[model samples]
Target: MKKKLLPLALAAAVLAGTMAGCGSSSAASSAAHNTAAPAASSSSSAASSTPSAENVTLNFAIWDSNQEKGLRKIADNFEAANPGIKIKINVTGWSDYWTMLEAGATGGSLPDVFWMHSNEIYRYGSNGMLLDLTDRISKSDKFKLSDYPDQLSKIYNISGKQYAVPKDYDTIGLWYNKTLFDKAGLKYPDETWTWDTLYNAAKKLTKNGVYGILTPLHNQEGFYNFIYQNNGKVISDDKKKSGYDDPATIQAMEYYTKFIREKLSPQIFGDKERAEAMENGLCAMGFFGSWNLSGFAENQYMAKNFDVTVLPQGKTRATIFNGLGNAISANTKHPEEAWRFVEYLSTKEAQEEQAKLGVAISAYNGAADLWVSSNKTFHVKSFIDMVKYAVIRPYSNKTTAWEDRAYETLKPCFTGKQTVKQACQNTAKQMNEALAAE
Candidate 1:
């Protein structure tokens, strides 16, 4: 996991570089609109007393609409317990959510409480845009930092200040269409499978109209796992450089791209398209996160024909683990109420509800068992079992900046325009520059 250390000057420089490349007037307009919106009244300090019985609505923001039903249920339960507060959920897709939050940060209109990601936490927390929950957490009787995973709790803690609370976590898994396996006369993926096994199965399954797999250029669900499994690092332990140019990293990249080059996987499919293709039976296998449970459970074909297993091994076994954190705006009018709600969301009861709805694997340790048993259609235990071998998702203060550049810089290899080694070399050069600037 990445630590927070970006200086404001470095952050500004990276943001300028990013925005200069994005020449979209519509995005600028949206930012302008967000800047002009009304902001929550600034509180003098964190509230220490129970909120009075005055009706108040807290603006809760999240990116995943698929989990809205479960969250709404949790909100309703919170309302029932408190009686004087109402929670209004604001659903925005992943990309737009950050854009709006960036705009909101500038205008002081960020949602009263919102979800925070590791990639952007340093930016917001360092800017003082998030409420300082350190004092409140210490004073609270119902919450304890030890209730969630230590790494997850530490992710949102910037410079000794607790800015957010862990909400849910996910680990990558190998999803396969069993029907395709049966048709290919291949056995189901299991603990004994390795990279070579996956390669051989993909070759055999690539017949007719369906490709054997879908290997999108996604860092989390795609190449990052392979890099780690091959004993290669993404960023160094000191967070000072890129590891893309390492021999093992390059080898892993070449191995992953081989699927695309051999036509065992589609050459063109974004993350969403890959999932849809899998659901529609155009692909036989793919690497995805535990959050896909909600969508897969609802998809008629996937519910009956799809299942998951631990990712095949490389030199060693590994999976990327990441989670969402719930945070409050620094300028919220009702700090006490917001804390009450945020705290409620982290409780074991709320987490269990989140799990039982099949929304996500709750961050609370034992609560994941409920999630595994919530749905019986697939081997959900595979996701939890992989946790023992999980590696925290690698990130840096300016992770998005370098991550975006690496993706674009490496695109040529995916299209056969450049050799994998050349692409890896170029990506390392650019990523190093980005890290140096930060």
Candidate 2:
């Protein structure tokens, strides 16, 4: 289940060296647009065991650049506390991140420590690519699996061995154009807004070369929320079957794509286009994740015209929620140093610092409020408020394998090439085939 599309020329760069920081220059440029702001560095009082890697530069790879500033500050405190070990942060886009990881995994030179997600964690953990942290976590007084969200912790555990620690959790939010809403005389979206309310707003706002909303062919930030909101699951809870064919799921899909069918949303296909549409005022609203805060905040247009609120509910209140994990390479030369850096990241100090810096919603218990306070530019508390009914982003052992396959089958529905029901039914068939093989 590995994506081996990484160019061979870049494989050498993935090794610890001058070029170890970034894999795809183009992806980096797009991702770096939204990033960190200056914040006070907060140090930990916790102690570390003597490290063998006195001058080792631990390459820490992550996808979102929005977090780089905050994380770098945290790393500075860590280095100040422990003089010898150095942490080099590598920022890459989401797609390139996996390719770089796959290249490193296959070539036995993966980043000493990197980010892991529910979609790909199973492949890495099951393949013996990640260091087992269960014992270390049990031995440490500074870190504990119980300190984080239980669902997030379980995502990185396979067969009772913990491969990673929860870094942060994110839920989708409704990002809307405040300027456009004011012009249209429409009230801002709130917790009371339902699917019907969203559609009505989109219709009212769609006029004079402007879309009321943009829901692309994306899943996590698109129709997936609607499916769960309507009581339709993606993968079954037991991880054995597809729920795409559920009547409720198909109904929700129909409603989600209606904006496009009615020409209220442009047929935006790529991830970058989604953000651009909102930034350029081509669309009045879109669903984005909490991870986008740093980037979105830095964008002047978004800062002036946009504010995020909880996603509009359907049959019930729900949002597609998921968290990232920090994992060490099973093949890393400096295992002790890698664990030390990862341990620091998992500590309460680091997690709260992450929230205070608006990196992401820290998965640590009680850290969400600080994250809410970190950003005053918008009603970010809405991100934390939705936690009550947040659905852990759907997953299974072969999540990545089935997700793209299902997307290929259902993308046509967004373009009006197929009916939503037909697209969903076809997706179910392909998803079940992939799941059965697993």
Backbone clashes in model 1, listed as residue pairs: none
Q: What is the C-alpha lDDT profile of model 2 across 113-173, one tens digit per residue?
A: 9988788888999999999999999997787899998988998999999999998888888
Candidate 2 regions with alpha-carbon error over 4 angstroms: 1-43, 46-53
On lDDT, the candidate that comes out on top is 2
TM-score of model 2 relative to the true fold? Answer: 0.91
Candidate RMSDs in order: 9.2, 6.5
Model 1 over residues 374-422: C-alpha lDDT tens digits?
Answer: 9898899999999999888877887887887788888899999999999
Off by over 4 Å in 1: 1-51
> Candidate 2 at residue 436, lDDT?
94
